[model samples]
Target: MPAPQFDPAAPLQFVVNAAAGSNAAASKREIIESVLQAQGRRGELAFCTPADLARVARVSAQKALSTRTAVVAVGGDGTLNTVAQAAHAAGCAMGVVPQGTFNYFARTHGIPADPAQAVRLLLHSVPAPVQVAGINDRLFLVNASLGLYPDLLEDREAYKARFGRSRWVAFVAACTTLLRAQRQWRLRIETGGTVRDVHTLTLFVGNNRLQLQQLGAEPEDTIAGTPGDGSMAALVLRPIGTLSMIGLMLHGAMGRLGEAAGVERFEFDHLVVRPTLPQGRRGVKVAFDGEVTTMRAPLDFRVLAKPLYLLGPQRSTATAEAVSRAEDAGA
Candidate 1:
């Protein structure tokens, strides 16, 4: 991948999600200030509360776009998504500090999980063009899904609020959702001139190769080989019995989802999915990245030809080594 242009003299604008765990810490602001002061760099930090994140992100993005400043998101995927929407709108380079439950986007881009390290890396990194996927104009850096997956996200959120956010909690929530809502939707999918009807419990469209590998939807060998290809991997889970669904869940938990029966995977530049029944025309629930939203019928999914410039390590041997180390640390 080609490196995005960067100016060392430009100011950095950090949009911190105060709701994020790292930002909730009282010393986070001091840490950021101290780091930049030590580096002799100037930065403006904007704290975004849960109630006004959208507004704060938009204003920050507008400032970045106007001033040609780098806007860094200091939170998880949801925070990144909000800032990304603004950055994309303003046509400015975006950066991220992984401070969320699952920092898939940051991990995929080789960003360190440690907040101080992440900020230091951002200071030295340049903009890199990365592929961005969309479900009806909403941009997502990782993946988007429909049907039972969205329901699972909803259930997971509720469970998270009650039991706390953890891998085990998420797993339990997934089980609860699967057992409680076994309803399947019949969708008519069209991609690359092929039109087919399918009854699926969930459909996932993945843009991040690392996430695809984790889900076992793509072969490990092909994960790093395909980047900025302007294509996405789609995994469709067909309707199955309760026992079989449980088995599928086990396979997914084991990182063998691709080996599970009734799971279909495809790579496409564009796809159109619609419900076979008139009742489905109302709207379809979609989970983009980790945020849930309702999208109208005939959901159009595609990759933007123009990439989003993100502040991250330039793809190189050293970067690869760093990413490997980060992955090992995360594991």
Candidate 2:
């Protein structure tokens, strides 16, 4: 497929998620409007709650598709995922305004963290192809996990509710979850036509290179050489004692998980994971991006053949600098 051309004069449709981080402020609307006016761009803003983001995004995307404009997601990765689904379906370009806790997708694409800067960048940026992966038919931009990881996410949400949201609080919650987790999954994994049975604490499938680097699983060369290869990297943590698990957590925190023992990493175009026991049928909890859901046994994961067109700075400058800094900082 040919790359979509970006037009500076094109109209933009902004889909805002009010519950997103930094978006709940009353002044945000004024800031966005001011920026659009300053840029002399035609833009329409629509607000929606988290629950209605997907439907609103689809409506906005359809309008953009008909108008030959771009649809911008003004929230986090989950919001971006929702909007991207519509944009991809309509063959329209997508942009971001990064108002979330992690904003991993936006940061990786070299979109600035500041709302004003992100808006300006998107206004002048071009459409670039980005790879996205899927578990069953649901798409995810970052990574997806099963087992202890999903449980940790649930615990993290509870912690956030009780104590409020902050990086330190999230870290503490993760540590607590790690210390208390006692379960493991005995699973059968099929990839590349080979089946293997193993006991693991968690399984992670990653599509974002920066995330893989942060986890210390993929080397710089591998990532640089195949930035959009339409494949996902798998990191499997074999069952281990609590002490060893703590040690592994420490390694991961320090961005050195690749050197951690009992870690297995591989790349595949498609794979299937199922419980080794016949009686383990009740469906498994899988966490994608920041959302959790239950999928029946024998989960199917694969790379999407088509790429999503995202509006951001070209890889040669912005992305290269961000990646270089992350590498230098050992992140």
Give TM per candidate.
0.90, 0.91
Residues 121-155 of candidate 2: C-alpha lDDT, one tens digit per residue: 88888888888778887888888889888988899
- Flag clash pairs in model 2: none
TM-score, structure 1 vs. true: 0.90
Task: Please name the candidate that would achieve the greatest TM-score relative to the true structure.
Answer: 2
Q: Please report the TM-score between candidate 2 and the true structure.
A: 0.91
lDDT score of residue 164 within candidate 1: 92
RMSD of 1: 3.1
In order, candidate lDDTs are: 0.80, 0.81
- The positional error of residue 187 in candidate 2, measured at the CA in angstroms, is 1.8
Scored against the true structure, residue 283 in model 1 reaches a CA lDDT of 77
